[model samples]
Target: MKAKNDAPLRSRQLIGYFVFSILLNGFGNGLTVAMNLGSALWTASAVNLAHALHLTLLTVLLAEGVAVVLFNALVLRRLEWRRIAGNFIFMIPFSFLVSWFAQLIGMTPLVALPLMWRVVLDLFGIVCTGVAVSIYQRLNVMLHPNDDLMQILRFHFLHGNAALAQPLSFVPPITLILICVLATRQAYALNIGTLFSLVAQGAIVGLADRVVFPQLKHRHLVV
Candidate 1:
């Protein structure tokens, strides 16, 4: 069935999932910023670009969301304006939450922490990202626009070739970060976390999809 045509889940239930997902996302973002490194590949690129352009990270994310929506519309030959708009609206709260969490964590203090603790935070961030992404996928309301773009690229553009599509989705984002880093002479955007996310996010998400989503499905708690 077309995603647009699917019936809406109960409002209360869906909202609960949304809240939980956003919290995870916000916390993960906090850890990323606190570690003074990239937590996710696409995020790294977006953050770097935002820095280079002297724009707020939220602004860059919103722009990227719009671009993804446009790209999806072009490829699908149909515009799901509601989904696009929903995702765009979702970004505002997400940005604020991330900012709040980032501030709450106190980046300066986090950076000054011992190296072992920093590694722990990085791992925690990755886990948060993995679980949050998985829950978001199961909720089936609206995707974090770029995620939807990645799906479209994987299924529509790559024709279900996971091998190619998976890596393709990551390469551009990391490459963008690399370019900006070299040009601006700023290495903050690319770090151990970036490499960790590139390698581990897939495994983590895959495990969640295989193990977590199934349990949620069994409980009839998710669509």
Candidate 2:
């Protein structure tokens, strides 16, 4: 039903949406830092390694990015250079927003607040992360290499069955979490935020589909 020439315009629109989603993801990351706890699974693993190896968090994150690219290339049996480039490009804005938001909207003022307040902040982060990820998934456009690999595995190997896709997608991050937990012997290697992110992924996506996406459509923010 779509015209052929619409492809280019649609592609550009998807790219724009993807960029916006990544920025929200970055804000979510900053909020996680503000919570003074471990972030989502992948980031928690990276943080664990950063502390143990005495390396900068960004350096370890870049290593993880490269590993993801290699894994995607292997699984898909093709080198998507655009995905490779996207990893680099997304990291730039992601890292910047994380740092900027951490300072601008940090939890510093809430140091004296109760645990419930911090929990509220973390929940907000979860919402941001959940909505951003949901939008990204719905767009069915370009993704970071790590996410692309997960989607590929979900679609190709799992036949797009969400039950299979969900558990299987956790493999990489869980592996990283275990490795860090065993290496560091930290009881909190996987903190509440990370665990919640994993468990609530489905709910979050559903919320976005039912609630957030409609708002975007009504506002003509995404097409």
Candidate 3:
């Protein structure tokens, strides 16, 4: 009789885990798609300096994403602050190389759009990414290596005060935005779009970490 009761509880736990995992992944996929699309659009639109900046951003983001995946899969295995910082430092050159390539490709400015529209899009993307991270963390699953690093920084350096960490977290994205703004007078038109795209991408990646790749060890246990 005790065994029978335990069986149902185990089944329920399994079902709950699976459901959360699916939700996390689904949200991640959506964010990824949105951010990639936004980046592509910005890259294809910006001219000369603006274009160069866009490409640089893309290259850096891609390098960071790849590095995070590898670090998580191989080196860190579990969250470690030094390992995360090392990963970031290692990827810096890749970011520079990508920027150089963008220059070689000869970037051009994008067609002008309303300033408000740009701002709206950018804000949307940023908000989405933040929300995604929150959701995934709440799921209590493993995070992508890059995110793990960010979380580590937030916890250790900022003493787990999200409010304090939040501003610091925006440093990279904000720097990129500033670069874009300074590169072209017309960049004002793209502020919103750029912000939204980045945030949305973050959110999506967070979701993926939770839902798509949820607690693989637990699943293995069940099997």
Best-matching candidate per TM-score: 1
Task: Residues 6-56, candidate 3: write the lDDT tens digits.
Answer: 222255665575345434333332322233223312222322233545554
* Between candidates 1 and 3, the lDDT winner: 1
- Candidate 3 deviant stretches above 4 angstroms: 1-50, 53-60, 66-126, 139-141, 144-146, 184-223
- lDDT for predicted candidate 2 compared with the true structure: 0.64
Q: What is the lDDT of candidate 1?
A: 0.69
Task: State every prediction's TM-score relative to the real structure.
Answer: 0.82, 0.78, 0.40
lDDT of 3: 0.41
TM-score of 1: 0.82
Q: Give the number of the best model, judged by lDDT.
A: 1
Query: lDDT scores for all predictions?
Result: 0.69, 0.64, 0.41
lDDT tens digits, residue span 65-180, model 1: 66667766776778777767867777767767766776788646777889888877877886787778766756656677766655556556665343345456676677778788
C-alpha RMSD by candidate, in order: 3.9, 4.9, 11.1
- TM-score (C-alpha, index-matched) for candidate 3: 0.40
Selected candidate, larger lDDT, 1 vs 2 = 1
